[model samples]
Structure formats: structure tokens, C-alpha cells
Target: MYPQRDVRVRHARDLAFSLLTPEDAFELLAFEIAERAWFEQHIEARREQFYTPHGMSQHIIECLALNAQGRMSPLLIRHKGVIIGRANLHDIDQNSARVGYRLAENACGQGIAHKALNHLMKEARCIYGLDTLTATVSVDNKASQRVLEKAKFTVVDKLPTYSQVVDQRLGCVVYQCALREKVECP
Candidate 1:
């Protein structure tokens, strides 16, 4: 399990992931607003309330609560001190967790996500004692698939209409990373 405190991980010169907190609500809101259109095309549709600062503050509070319970690790992805997007390890179960990430439109194709995910995987093993990490990507999101593949995740399953994005149901491809033998766990 993670320690009873926030963790900030820096993967490269300008890329890092910091544990989310209530104080980050405004920056999160700004990131959401900037990436809303780009992200809506891939992930499930977010509620209108999620676009507001008040709603995001509540969301951050809930995430922190989950973090306290060792059920989730909500992190804000930053590039040179600006919140670029989010990277989360949620649905944490014994020795396993689900990972997901979103980057600003301008940050795409820069190998940032790959480095960030690699760092997260290391943290998952060392901090959370997680041996397995899973991620689900929309079938149409080939870029994300590439990122996962580059991070050593293998395609393990496919789901028909796994989630609803906007008005359409999108198929998903599930990827799994087995790190039990790759990392030393406490």
C-alpha cells in the first residue's frame, strides 16, 4: 500500500505527476477546459458539472478520500509547472490496479506519456505493491494503443461497446502489464 501522504514523481526534465489535492481544482479545471474537446472523442462523456470549479473541487476531494483509503491515486500531469493533464491509478485491488492518462493536445506525440507511465508503473510496484496494471483504450485511439504498447503492455482482451462517449458506444481494447518479475516489491 501507499504511504499515508502525497507523492510527487518526476519522470523527466519537464514532465511529472503530483498527487491530486483540493488546492489543484482550479488548475484541473483549466486543463479540463483546454482538453475537453480532444478528450471527449476518446473517453466517456463527462457531466456538465465536471466543467465547473465547484464540481472539480468536489471531485478532487473525493479522489483524495479514495487515496486515503488506498483505492486510488489521482495525479495531475505537469510539464514545466503547468498542468498538462491527468494520470490516474484507480480501481486498486490487491496486487493490481487500473491505469489511465490524458495529455494536452500539444503534448501528444512527444513521448511524454510513455515516460510518465513508466514512472507510474515503478511507483505502483514499489509504493502500492501492485504486480499488475491494466489499461483500456478506445479501439479508435491508436495513439494510446501505441503508448501502452511502448510501455510494454500487451493486448489481453477486447470489449464490444465497452463505454459510451458522447452519443456513440465505443469498443475497447484492454492491455495488461505484468510487473511481478520486473520490479522488486516490499
Candidate 2:
């Protein structure tokens, strides 16, 4: 099981990262609504229900359940107490996890993603006992690629057709970060 306490990391005077809880449903829904178009530009289209409060609440519940199973850690990006984005360490295994993140349109180009990711990497290694992390970014998403690079993840592969995002099959770059000399999975 995961720790009950929230994971918090402060990057600057205004930007912070915190573990998202079920109570954050409304705020997260608001952020998702506001940034829907912006996020869709980079990733796959979200289900229509995901924009609703009920759907968001259900999603939060699922995230919490995953955390309980030691399979995921979903976090919110907050700027001056306002929810602005989300980051997740998902598909967790014994010694590794996959990372994904998204920022509000207004929060872009402010170094928030890079800082948040760097902090999450530390927490994943030290607190969660994960020894390696991986992330996949669309080739066209230079911003996200840069964020992964800034967090010291090395490019490991390139897929000409990685996955479908909306109607297109997007090419992607796979990145990995090794956190420790050895990983022991219980």
C-alpha cells in the first residue's frame, strides 16, 4: 500500500505539486475543462464524460484505488493555490513506473513541468522505492520532450507510429531514467 500522507514539492514561490485526492474533483474538473483543447492538441482525445464533475470524481476514485494497489500516483500541479495541471506515475511495477503530465494552457512555458517532474522523480526514487522511470512523448511535442530531457531521462527508442491520438497515428520518443544502482522488488 502507498503512504497516506500527501506528497508535496515546492518549486517556486507560486508553483507546487501535491498528491491529488478525491476532494479535488471539482478543481481538477475545472482545470480539465479549461485546458481541454490545449491537451487534446498533444494527446488522445479524452472521453466526453471526463469533462463532467461526476466523471472526474470517478477518475479520482480510480486513481486513489490505484494508489492503494501500489500501481499509480496521481498529482496535481498547483500555482498559488489554484489547480493548473496533472502529473501521474502509472503502470507501476516492482521497480519502475511510467510518467505522464499535462499543464494548463496558461501554465505553459513557465518551467513548471520540468520542475514538477524533477521533484516527482525524486519522490519516486526515495519515497516510493522505484528504481527506474519511463516516459513516452509524441515527436511533435517538443515542449514535453524538453521537460523529460531536463529531468535527465535518456532517449531509448523512436517509434514511427507509437499510438493513435485522435485521428492520427503519432510518432513518439521513449525515454528512461535509472534512479539507483540496483532495484529489489518485493
Q: lDDT per residue, candidate 1, 1-186, as tens digits?
A: 111212233444677689997788777787787678878987886899988878888899899999999999998888777877688899998889999988877777777788778877988998998989999999999998998998789999999999999899999999999987666655
- List where candidate 1 sits over 4 angstroms from the true fold: 1-12, 184-186
User: Of the candidates shown, which would achieve the greatest lDDT relative to the real structure?
Assistant: 1
User: lDDT (0-100) at residue 19 of candidate 2?
Assistant: 86
Give the best candidate by TM-score: 1
Looking at model 1, the pairs that clash are: none
List ranges where model 2 is wrong by over 4 Å: 1-12, 181-186
The 0-to-1 C-alpha lDDT of every candidate, in the order given, reads 0.83, 0.81
Residue 10 lDDT, candidate 1, scale 0-100: 42
lDDT of 1: 0.83
Which digits, one per residue and each the tens of the lDDT, describe model 2 over residues 70-145?
8998988887788777889999988999999888776677778887787778778877889899999999999988
